[model samples]
Target: MPSKPLTTYVTHQPMTAVQVLEKAAEIVAERYFHGDVFCSAKATKDFLTFKMGGYEREVFAVMLLDSQHSMIEFRELFFGSIDAASVYPREVVKVGLEVNAAAIILAHNHPSGVPEPSQSDKRITSQLKDALALVDIRVLDHIVVGETCVSFAERGLI
Candidate 1:
């Protein structure tokens, strides 16, 4: 028997961690594109859950949307400790203006994996809603992501 040299093939580029995440986020965003109204609470929750569910600390993010509810951008605005984050409405409003977003879906992960909105969550949602309303921006939903996502809009909190 004759010895044969091993053969190998490289069909795709090896992606970095960040590149992989970016590609995944792009795919998630694509699911919301083919619609007149991008206001499906379940879909929004599902999408956000995939994006924010695996954090060890808290991450506050927003899905900025145009007037017709199409995506303008998805941004992680604040990073915090395992249990708490100081979410600034001014900064959020600034990004909304910068992106020219007409509405936003707020999300944050509970690293503890409970997915329950605490008192602070309720308070901030109210504050953010009122603050954004001042600038003619709408807060469509706030999703608390953990093992599962809990939606404020679905519960009539938004």
Candidate 2:
């Protein structure tokens, strides 16, 4: 029998949501918060992955914002076993209350590397919109972040 060479593969790490967003905020604040710098989807995803490490499955998050739309908190609310995560409107509302968030920006990752919102994604956003409306919390945007990120408010999808 002939000897064969062994192969190795790189493994990715994981990080908390706060770590990811803090880096993003730092980057945005450093170059674009009060300036004219443009942040593309690729840039955002790179920043997140660099700070938090790559994700293996889908994860949904909520970025609580103040009245000025600045980030107050980054929360990873739910983790899905596969490509989809279950989002509870009531739980989201509770989180909004707990954080005293005047507005929120929702985000989720697609393990498949596609950032386009599915029909279910839109439906969930609409539901969350209606639920939050009851409590007077505005949904500033729903952003899907993966290989790319799309913003509902930016694209007028919402």
Error of 1 at 102 (Å): 0.8
| Residue 147 miss distance in model 2 (angstroms) | 1.0
Q: Which 10-residue window in model 2 sums to the lowest lDDT?
A: 32-41
**lDDT by residue for model 2 over 120-141, one digit each (tens)?**
9999999999999999899877
- Which ranges in model 2 have alpha carbons more than 4 Å from their true place? 1-53
lDDT of 2: 0.74
Instruction: Using lDDT, give the best candidate's number.
Output: 1
lDDT agreement with native, every candidate: 0.86, 0.74
**How well does candidate 2 match the true structure in TM-score terms?**
0.72
Q: Residue by residue across 44-89, what tens digits does model 1's lDDT show?
A: 7767776777678999999899988888888999999999988999
Clash count list over all predictions: 0, 0
